[model samples]
Target: MERIDRRLGLLFALPVSAILAGAFLAPLLVVAIFSTMPQKVFDFLHWPDFSSYRVILEQGYWRSILWSLGLAFTATALLLVICWPLAYGMARVFGRFTLVLTVLVVMSLFVSENIRLFGWFLTLMKGGLIEGHLRAWFGQGFEGLLFNVPAILFGLVYVYLPFMLFPLAQGIAMVPDDARAAAFDLGASRWQVFTQIELPLAAPGIMVGSLLTFVLSAGAIAEAKLLGGRAVIVIADDIETAFTFAQNWPLGSALSMVLIAVVGTLVILGLRRVDLDAIMGRRR
Candidate 1:
């Protein structure tokens, strides 16, 4: 019976594994191969090398790479500030109210990012809802505020906030009420309980949330392209330009390879503190 069950499990997993390879790993391998070749030699039969990476590092590409990193890190930091308390509030409360609120938050994630950005565009432009309110309250000096970095930041936060909240809610929910009671019973102040007990316990969730938010925001081209216009250029946009307009597949592939390397390094560092295997529930 055990052997049959094992065979059945492998059978079910085979298609999924094949799909993942074709969809993800195969493309990545192709990209890696292309990144090492010259643009003229598009043939996969050619040998690969590091010439593409040399060009990437020795050009103006670094600026866009830095900008993408900055934007992603900033958005992730802002998300932690905004979503932690919101997640805590949702998790702390009981009843249908929490259910309704959770549904709303999840619904925001359902809306396409482009649609959300367009909605914000109308809201934040001059003579729009936000502008009208600002003019009425803070006066007319608030002009030219929405079409730049602020808009990009807002879009990023709005899109990725749910990713931050869900993990945090899970972490906070895992904190037993009895544990809180025991901490309080041991003469721990509210702040102490939160800082020393609650936050420490929830660290893994926060780390995961930050990682997701940062990576998504880093690779985000639509938000920056639409909201930021040409005022701000991100690495992903640069890659798109290389692939589409510049027709420089090797350079674009190289940039993507660099991004993959950076993200992999960060994930390795993050996994040091958090039990990644446990977090991913792979323990037998």
Candidate 2:
């Protein structure tokens, strides 16, 4: 019976495995092949070389890579700091209100991303809602809110907050109420209970959320384009320019491979420290 169940599970997983190979791995393989090929060459008669990678090693290109990494890291860190307390509240303190909060978060996902960003654009624009209100009340308003680095960061945080929040809430929710009560009964302060118990138990979710936020933020082109204007140049923007405007597929593929490698390494490292079963509330 157990053998039959195991075979059935494997059979069920075959479709997903095939889909991943075709949809994900196939594209990556194509990108890898193209990354090694000479740029501006569409012919089959071409030699694989490191020229594309050498282009990426240039000072200007390297700066874009650093910029993307820095933005992703900063945004992920901020999300963790902001979401931790919010998730804890949703999991423990809010009780019936948690449902309302969850619905709000999920609703954001249903709205178009571009529409949400456009709303932010209007809010921050000169003579828009924020400036209008400020000018009306304070007789002065700042007009430098849009088309800047801070605007891009704000948009990114707003868009990705829910991704971090849900996993963190789930992790915190899995912490046993009895364990918390026992800690309190043993004269442990609330701070001590949270610091020593809750935080440690929620580490897996924190890692997952951080990885997701970092990966998404790093690859973001739309937010940078809309909010950053010409002041910011991220790796994703560079990749898009390379492929589209510059007409350099090899260079674009090289940049994409580098991003894929970095994100993949982070995910592997995070997974090493996180227990999937624990995070999913599943028994082995």
Residue 31, model 2: lDDT of 86
TM-score of each: 0.88, 0.91
> Quick one: best TM-score, which candidate?
2
Model 1: residue 258 alpha-carbon error in angstroms: 0.7
Which 10-residue span in candidate 2 carries the lowest summed lDDT? 37-46
Model 1 clashing residue pairs (backbone): none
lDDT of residue 160 for candidate 1: 89
The TM-score of predicted model 2 comes to 0.91
Give me the candidate number with maximum lDDT. 2
User: Which portions of model 2 show Cα errors greater than 4 Å?
Assistant: 1-17
